[model samples]
Target: MTSESQTAGTRVLHLSSAQLARVSRALDGDEAAAAEFDSALSSDPVRLLVEVLSTKSVPAGSGVSYGHTFVTQHPTVLARVAIGYGHGLPRKAGNRAWVTWSAAGGPAVRLPIVGRVAMDEFVVDVGRTPVEPGQLMCVFGDSDEGEVPLGDWAAAIGESPVSVIACLDRRVTRSVVE
Candidate 1:
């Protein structure tokens, strides 16, 4: 049984039939099922980090993204990120979700994902933070600034992580950095 892990990086666990049974028992609220199951599952290591492709400062009440679902309440800086539903970011993440970005000498900022998630692009309201075109953004996963946990995103979309994570498009590059 292979699962994502943080801290020590990735590991592949080949659980035997007996071990699988133990994991099943443990999941069923068994108090003393298997120590391996308890020790194995740790912080999720999967992170979808992408580059900001562009940035623009829009005036107050400006309509954003496709269909104008999000109209800015005030003048704000916006960014176009590289990922979209076509890249495995869910369309449901449109106006309901957010991403984080860290500026060189400044603290991390939470930016709302505005408008509809397109096939290959999405917009984010960066608020007052001055964002650049090449800055990296945390679409999801853990970081020093914080995290966009899978559970939070799942809750926002009324779906499970198992259903959503797999939606990440295969065409998107995936790297294993240890």
Candidate 2:
């Protein structure tokens, strides 16, 4: 009935602070509210970077990853991303999900996670991309250059985004960006 009651109802629905801001935008014509919501919703706080620990050139018929879950159908370039279950990368991600990788100054390439993700690393089919030792791979996060969104990982592994992110091991090196 009253403006105060409407605002109070919106706030009572357990909406996030960002969602509340959007509601306030409609109620009070606060232009800044939209900006705040966008910043909060779209910006991921945790970005993961994995180094390429090694690379193997596999001929067709080669088994990849752990347990031979993936067998190369053709000649392929495989690289090991140096973060694994021990680093908070879920074992369930193996052979089911993908990671974003790029050569220096190159466009991002999507690579499949093959085999069982080990405790310390996982295998990716680089597929002729020129990957080298120490090249960076995005494990998960928001990047201006683009990345595998957390939702995609969730869908791949049948987990919720919160669970996917919350399981990250505390030993991970976290760097904050503005």
Candidate 3:
């Protein structure tokens, strides 16, 4: 609904239920469903903050591009994350892309990708987090206290705020907490 400037160099873009509905229609084409989904995500206090990590090391001879690249080494922790380009994650996010994140009781962290990001899957370092399937990932939203933000990631990727919100699929679970 309103845009505010933060001291941390990130701009907070607020969206109301009505504004989010418009974006949902543009992305999903079902106004009713979109409205419902938007209502769920908007009402939540915990925001999404996607952190990309590298899964493998690219060889020196190999040049990693957008969607094509191979892991020349082993022991790669390929991050099977829930967020991807289809969810408004940036397509330009190549291998070794950086994202800021923080766990339930840990400090904010930064991680990188090891391989090319597929349509639905992208990798991350996950240095800690003890990641497992369905471990609650914040791909793009606000943070605890609405302080640490993911808005910079959207701007850096040249993605419109509306498009980012639309990218989030209805399948992703949403929860609200005070």
Candidate 4:
């Protein structure tokens, strides 16, 4: 298995425009090809996952229920990520939401939230992990041995994974890597 330092050096390698076009043309209606494409793009294409640290510390007692509980904490580190309730993240995940994240050397760490996810922000407890802004936050991507399947995440929050993925507006940018 690769170490954190090894994976951290790799830059964001995206698919070339020509290569994307070729794949698009080659797999017009082939199911297997489509599946392969999905696996390659979403899975560990580089045989490694990016390791990023938390930027801020979202405090406790911050009520996060939608149209319900009110946040009571001030110094909280809201995950400055793109995915939110509108992007399929559970709005009802009032302090129950957990995401598998990777720090330096330890196994993929599961970061628990303190409140419900807002329209564009979520809180995470970064006890002592050295994190900072612009770090790669794997909201819903690959994992070490298993993956945080979008379907499972949706099920946990009582939402349809299909609709959750579909609701990802065009504003949410996506990049394909080879």
The TM-score measured for candidate 2 stands at: 0.72
lDDT of 4 at 129: 52
For residue 34, give model 2's deviation from the true position in Å.
Answer: 21
Candidates ranked, most accurate by lDDT first: 2, 1, 3, 4
Candidate with more favorable, higher lDDT: 1 or 2: 2
Predicted structure 1: lDDT: 0.65
lDDT against true structure, model 2: 0.66
Give TM-scores for every candidate, taking all chains together and pairing residue i with residue i.
0.72, 0.72, 0.52, 0.53
Clash count of each predicted structure? 1, 0, 13, 7
Q: What is the C-alpha lDDT of each candidate?
A: 0.65, 0.66, 0.48, 0.46
The parts of candidate 2 lying over 4 Å away from their true place are 1-41
Q: In model 3, how large is the Cα lDDT of residue 170?
A: 47
- Candidate 1 residues lying further than 4 Å off, grouped into runs, are 1-42
Flag regions of model 3 displaced more than 4 Å. Answer: 1-46, 49-76, 128-133, 143-148, 173-178
- Give lDDT: candidate 4, residue 41: 42
